[model samples]
Target: MNFDTNLILSIMPELARAFGVTMLTWVAGVIGAALLGFLVAVARRYGSRWLGYPLRLCVEVIRGTPFLIQLFLLYYGGPFIGLSLEPIPAGLLGLTVYGAAYFSEIFRAGFEAVPPGHVEAAECVGLNRRQIIQRILIPEMTMLVLPASVNMAIILLKETAVLSIITVPELTLVISAIGSQQYAFVESLFLLALFYWGLVELAGRLGRYMEARFSKYRFVTA
Candidate 1:
């Protein structure tokens, strides 16, 4: 089949619009995930066994399940439970929940990596729990977890394509529909892959920049 450059050009405007939707969902999802995930990590690590056990189970269940299944349950099955949400909202919620599970794990690891002596020293210095967490724990953990967190963010971006299945009209859904209607599957798919590749590359570069900027905070042994 002939590659249709003109067809791709004609669809650029549509693709651009869909790209904006994709970015909006991704930014919202990542922000929500980061906040919720950090809270879960802190609670599971420091809270009572009753709270920790339940949160641990929740993280496990979410991580073990496929994101697509989770999305379906939220968007379709939610209405049965009187929790109906619009497509974009459902997509954002699913992405946040799914991404949070993974982010929490990353944070947990970062927390454990900090030496227990550090917390002890903070206590001896008369720093309260909140002060220690704000001044030391969070800054130190940020350096350790930034790489993994960035990777999770990229994964969340890619998963936005699945939102199309629920009629969110993200890049993948829009391009796929155009391809079907125009009978130009090759062009549509190629463009889709190209757009995703560019986004991933951009995300990777941003991650690296952040790592470099925060490198001084990372632990180093003498």
Candidate 2:
């Protein structure tokens, strides 16, 4: 098989353009995950068993099912429910829901890992539940949450591949379309592999830096 150098060069420009879209998906996915997961965790904590059970069930159901199915549900399944989501919206929604489930667990553990003394001290200082949660709990929980959040961000980055199925035009879809259109099969996929690897490497280094930074502010490294 003759490797077409010209084809690779042509595809590189398109891949580079699509790389921005890929990063957008990652950023949106993480934002969605963080907010959704935080809400779920809060609901579990404050909403008590009534609201908590359903949230837990939601997390379990999402985690149990494959993301491909969820993407289909958002992209293909929503129309039946009178929700017309575009491809990117569908993909974003699906990844958000999926990432939320994992992130909820991360958050729950993080909140739990908050030292009891912190909570008690906040109470003694006349902090109400809301105030204590906002100030004491969140700050204390960060020490625990930072590492897991770092992991979740990396996981979400990898999971962006699933968005391709919904035709979100993310990195995977971009490469797949290019490969099929141009038949620069090996080069296109190889470039994608390289792109994803580079992202993973960068994320690992950033995570280490974050760990060091956050660890400094952690209270007794509990």
Best by lDDT: 1
Candidate 1 — which residues are off by over 4 angstroms? none
Residue 182's lDDT within candidate 1 is: 97
lDDT by residue for model 2 over 102-185, one digit each (tens)? 989998998888878888888898999999889878877877888789888998899898888877777899888888887778
- In order, the Cα lDDT scores of the candidates are 0.93, 0.85
Tens digit per residue, CA lDDT, model 1, 102-161: 999999999888777788889999999899989878988899899999999999999999
User: Where in model 2 is the C-alpha error above 4 Å?
Assistant: none
TM-score of 2: 0.94
